[model samples]
Target: MSCLTARTGRQRQRYEGHLRLVSGCIPYKFEKSVGGSNCSTEKDLLVLMISSPSRDDLVFPKGGWEDDETMSEAACREAWEEAGVKGVLGETPLGDWEFRSKSKQNSCSLQGGCRGFMFAMEVTEELDSWPEQANYGRKWLTIEEAYRACRYDWMREALKKFVTALPESRENDTIKELEERPLRPISEVEHQMPSQGCFGSHPSIQQLAA
Candidate 1:
């Protein structure tokens, strides 16, 4: 069932030192042209972006990594609550970004610093109404428009990584590919984060907050 209410309060919010850890995704879907015709290329892929209630610019759905839920769960919940969409989240994150938040308690070493992890979601369903639908207006944009609409340097950079990581955007070498194992997952965060470790996805103590 879909949640009708958005979660609130920072009481259970998790923090690594002074920086708040946030999670979100670039929700995307494949489509044909406005007519019921098949897409010739991958150019028809669309990304969903939501309006920031406090700003004129659009932003991907994101929110706090509360103590109770896994980072991936938080990311998925934020997308559903804010943008009214649900989909499969990529195994690896698109990228991590440090940005400043307008909220006094969140930032990227500026005022209130925040460290955010973003993933690519292959959106499967969309709802007519969501928890934050009244505050966040959703729009579907092409990759080019999404890039131009980005309001922050980090957002743009993360978007670039997202594009690069897309399987459709890759070029293959046939001979080299023939020798490689197909089981290997394409992951960028793994090599760059040998020591940092991913924020665990499950198996938490499931602490209850009073």
Candidate 2:
């Protein structure tokens, strides 16, 4: 719920020894049906795009993953920081993409390349203003438009993979569920489940038997 709470003070120098790993979110929202159109069956997907601070290119929300947070957390944090949006992060990453960092001060400066983990984030809320609002501009575009507008080839590929994995109808359902509930991490949900056979011990199973 908190966006841009962490200070960007100084880039940590510790990652200078290894290849920089970044986490990012592909933020998406369901576009409402047109006034004249039937709402029952129509579902449109729109992806959020952010303008890069130093360039004219439009890119997804992404940043370096800190030592203290999980990859999902980092992706969610980046989405909030860069795009001023909050949502449920997907349990699995869409894929990894390799890119060369332009920042000379970071670890990628020496390595010349960085690995990015991309995940799907169903946008539930959008803030009026965000920390990087002055530096970045946000827009929502259709899948094809977003793909063509992407600044990096690797990112385009990631978008393609995410789209291919979830067709329009299924994606609509997923987005609806995320918006309806505050999703917990898959790990936490699994830990709370009873360790018994599917037909044993569970209340639902007992009711069915009765």
Q: For every candidate structure, what is the RMSD over all alpha carbons to the true structure, in angstroms?
A: 12.5, 14.6
Q: Which residue pairs show backbone clashes in model 2?
A: none
- Checking candidate 1 for backbone clashes, the offending pairs are 99-108, 106-112, 107-112, 107-113, 107-114, 108-113, 109-113
Roughly what TM-score does model 2 have, to 2 decimal places? 0.70
Tens digits of per-residue lDDT, candidate 2, 1-210, equal 443464474264124345678888788877766554454645788888887766656788888877777777778878877788887666677888767776643553456566788887778788776767667778787675666566566876677666655544344344344336553332231111111100111111111100
* TM-scores vs. true structure, each candidate: 0.73, 0.70
* RMSD (CA, angstroms), candidate 1: 12.5
What lDDT score is found at residue 18 in candidate 2? 52
* Model 2 vs truth, CA RMSD: 14.6
Sliding window of 10 residues with minimal summed lDDT for model 1: 188-197
lDDT tens digits by residue: candidate 1, 159-195: 6666656666432232134225332222211111011
